[model samples]
Target: MQDFYIFAKNFHINKAIIRRDGYIYQSLIAFFMTGTGNSYTVARWCAQVAETTGIGSQLVQIKAGEKRGAVPSRSLAVFTYPTHGFTAPWLIMKYIWCLPNGRNLHAIVLPTRAGIRIKGAFFPGLEGTAGYLIAFLLWLRGYHVQGVMGVDMPSNWTALHWGLSKQNAAVIIEMAQSKVKGMLQTVLAGNKHYDGMVQLLVGIALAKVSLMYLIMAQFILAKLFFASDKCNGCSLCQSICPKKALKMVGRQGRPYWTFSCDSCMACMNYCPQKAIEVSPFIITLFYYIATVPVFAYAMSYAAGGDALQWGISLGLGFGIQYGYTLAAIALAYGLLHVALGSRIIRAIAAKLSHTHYFRRYQASNVSLKDIHLHK
Candidate 1:
């Protein structure tokens, strides 16, 4: 009876050791590739949740577009990026492609967007399947996509729309925090959730040829940006550009936009003085009229002196028209700068402040300390 009792106690102790060892082995190491702008906040929140819930240890965070060392196969990877024009930014895609394929890797994709209310229903700020697309791409590269989620962040694109007020933004941030907590719970349970299928399909429909053309147009439109005398030669816009497309040159220390710009609008949105402005509507309209017909004729002539093919014609025509429009606008603005100088340009920009040409609204600056405190 004594021998049997001692064996039983030893067996229970061995079982407990085995269970603890298994738990330690199964704890996942997570890597988060955080996108720029508001995406940093979302990624930080995810890391915090993982640490608090004990779902993952050895968490690593890498900024989108930044270099990273080799990632291990037995790990969890989280990708977080801000949506641009209802799609993931190109910089995020570049990072995804660079990740080495691994059969045992698990992936979670989180896309942050500005929440918009349609009618009485609040649409989670996701415009399309930006999250699912990332998951699908990772799956293609041999990672098991555990989940995809959208987190509603305060909108920062004040160029096309007004930014959320401080009070409203605070409300949205709280709501997002709650949503993220629930998402982490589901993730820890080893379940999958994707809430943007319809948005995904719509995003796919819009992302094909039209998306390419729009990207090309943005490159051209970037040339239309000009700074007023209020610039103060601070070089803030130049420093903040992800693409390094803006250069501060000449004795006046003015910004010069190069062709390398991707039109992410980081410079304009983050400008403290709102000194950058685009050309007026009348000038843009005149440019389009002047260049479109000529490009259309040239494209038709190039196509064997026959009617241009629809796809080829559309692409070439729009590309040339946009390219010339931007060049002309820039040249005209440059000439004006040379003729009247910075003082006159500043006055003109101020006068056109109420016009649709200038981006009048500015996004509120993000406080890093506030984000850390939230954690």
Candidate 2:
């Protein structure tokens, strides 16, 4: 993937319109949807490079309920987001969908995937639909796509595993700094550089998985979160949530994740108490509950026959099962949240969550002030 970081030597800056787009783009606008600040760092790098080239730049964090604003003349909008479940996050999708016709701007897209340096080697994550999905949406909105590239930032999904060591994370982030600047320079020079075609194809092949994740997996993951015994009830997680999906509920004021949570890791990584956790026991329970075939059994009993062998209305059964899964998870999460207020239950729940043992991550340089996660 070393070569993925560089462009062809023959590539030269087009002083004129960046391509057939036929516009002198004077400003660089970067819009980033970030959780742990990986995408935020990428946006800053692009903006810095553009600034040095005498192009004024603006950085905007994509948040829910953000109103549409006027588009500037001869401007290029760069979108940087982390890849979630091999595709774009719902926040970004809705942002683009709500965008007014984009005849006024050109666009470039960069999706930062989970990347890390281990034993002096760099491994990149699969981006899937994270890149083209957004580009396609931009194109449909009438923005000329200048380019699309996947950036390798330090792996920030700490809930599933440990975070990269500072030494290893710095290596990956340092490489990304140079790579993102190159991508921005190439696009600004009126040359098109579409990277990650192979990853895109592979992601397309897993479209069903991505779709299921977007609709079901993500929603379920949202409910798996809980504030542990270590929580001092600071409510920092509630204030930092970009979607405002986290609520401090009951007498304890413990943070409770709602369905609106995008599982963006903002709450998990930024908790000073290190108390936010994904309950493995609950997740496992959810997995078994979802596969219990309760819907099939109900239908079988209602019809006085074996519905399983009959392949009875698989589509309808799936829909019913999906609802059941979500409903069950939500109800279970509520009970668990309340239960955790107890010392014994909280201790047991804390032990069951792998995240309690895993190291947390956020970009080294970013602060709550930087991304407005605090505001």
Candidate 3:
């Protein structure tokens, strides 16, 4: 990969022409959609910047469960996607793997993450490396990776954490737009950048652990998802599913997720009626109750003959500790949900839907060179 970068740098310095001519080579911007539409927002911003700056680009929206198609040859390619479990979505990686090699192609990556802010202090919600991973994959496929830019977007994982309110989300969007504009300006200036070593290390560690967790825990916990009487049989969840994991079943037309679910929580978050409910605390309690005793027994047996005693002791200790934590959190959230949280979230969602937040970037495919020349 280092050698590829060196070669790419020399090639660009000696022979490659960076120009505003749209006909010279194609530029492709591909992105994967999730419930919160964060990645979609970043992709649109990138396209707007590229076009406004006289770089022609095209948009490719990748849907879930779709088979890989031929990769289009291009001089520049920008990849954008949301982070899942502190890493790139597995589906996005698969798409990268299927892309045909782009010899001497220049690439940029924009990965959107949901970070938490407490008392004006920001903490990354996930170990973000989706951009880096995509860049590395592109490099392996003979593309000259320009940079990996991480954009912090509003939190969408309401199941595990509180989501941003409408006002807070608006603030975040404005800040992100400003940051993206600066980054794009640097890229258009032919400069190069990379993430810090610490971030890369953290991303690597999280990716490893997250992969295991996804395989072992996600499907089991997904069983907790259920639609209430409020579900109106709209089938919006089924239609929007990228993986085609959801199917409207029964006469009542409730959405049922299959094993193919990536657990992106799009269905749960976007449900209009607030019908689909997934209690993360309850899932946590169930997970510990089901697995803690077995794990404790195994560890105790490996240590000595008092396996039963050790197992019972360890199980009780962990169970009580985790149980108490989850219970308190659940109680607080339940009260908040009943009192105000539900209404607030629904209002925000309604605002977002009415504004067509996901569709705002529909004009991203316009040729920047034409626009510039026309002006």
Candidate 4:
């Protein structure tokens, strides 16, 4: 199942994007750390592999919830991230929609998720839909296109928590070599069915339900918990609030979420306030744990009776995957925070904001660690 297209593209590509969930801090560490299974790190490694094979390339970050400009020509735009509820982060949807065309633009979508094969199908679906839709839009707008590609990264946090003793850092390097090689082969072979397979996966009712949950989680629950007390009155949140839903109040302790909250969670995750409270990391952990059983129940609901055999099998398979995925992320968080300094988070927030969305708020005096953890 090796793809030759990926190989051909890898050897001659020029530009690419290295995406991450919720923040760039983790991504930067992943890039530097080598094995953490982070999307950015994995994608960068992939790019380098592609380079050695003859592709000249550049990698950039696509933050959790913002949009970026067109991928430069002859360049491969690589979108990477940890899957949230089986899909890319909510904000990444906009990025997919905005993908530029007309110049034989190629796409490489890398989704990092918990280590389950069932869940592995999720990101390909998201990437396919976004890519197909963009291609269609571009076609209408008069841009000739080549196509899109996708790869999966191990769920580092979940894997570590589940007792998967193998750190994702090493896997990062391995996946970069093997996965990129496979992708290159696929691309060169002109195998377009991957997109169709993505369509089939997404067409299912269960998949739709899963996607809806992700949307609500990002656009709803994520906002409330993200606004806790750790925010440092720094207006950085207000500055990058893509929806302009944040504003500084009387120069107090931190920027406050306004009525325009879209639940993007950028403020909560990136706020230097140390003022925001609540752990999105913890919340997501619980979410994966709880939903494992629910996916079981949902199948029962759809079948009019418990598909006990299917449920049992999937439960075991997906369960193991989730366990491993969660563990890896947790370990990554602990190791990077303690060893590398959570400053990666601040750096990511700053780098993420460096784009058009956060350009106005660039001059802030806030330090990445200036915000304290909530008591």
Which window of ten consecutive residues has the lowest lDDT sum in model 4? 24-33
**Top model number, TM-score:** 2
lDDT (C-alpha) at residue 13 in model 2: 32
lDDT string for model 2 (1-375, tens) is 111111122223333344444558667778898888999999999878877776667787888876555456577888999999999999999888777678747789999999977799888888998999999999998888989999989888887888888899999988899998988888877788899999999999999999999999999888888888898889989888888898898787888889999888988999998988877788888888777786785455346445663455555566777888888888888877777779678777888888888889989999988975544
Estimate the TM-score of every prediction.
0.74, 0.90, 0.69, 0.45
Candidate 2 Cα errors over 4 Å, as ranges: 1-22, 298-312
RMSD of candidates 1 onward, in order:
10.1, 7.0, 10.4, 15.9
lDDT on C-alpha atoms for all candidate structures: 0.59, 0.82, 0.59, 0.41
Candidate 4 lDDT tens digits, 205-319: 3456556655343433332232333344556666655456655544343344433454433454454543444344545654554354534543453354357766666766655
lDDT score for candidate 4 against the true structure: 0.41
**Residue 168 C-alpha lDDT in model 3:** 60
Cα lDDT, model 3, residue 300 = 47
Extract clashing residue pairs from model 1.
none
Once model 1 is optimally superposed onto the true structure by TM-score, how far is the C-alpha of residue 39 displaced, in angstroms? 1.0
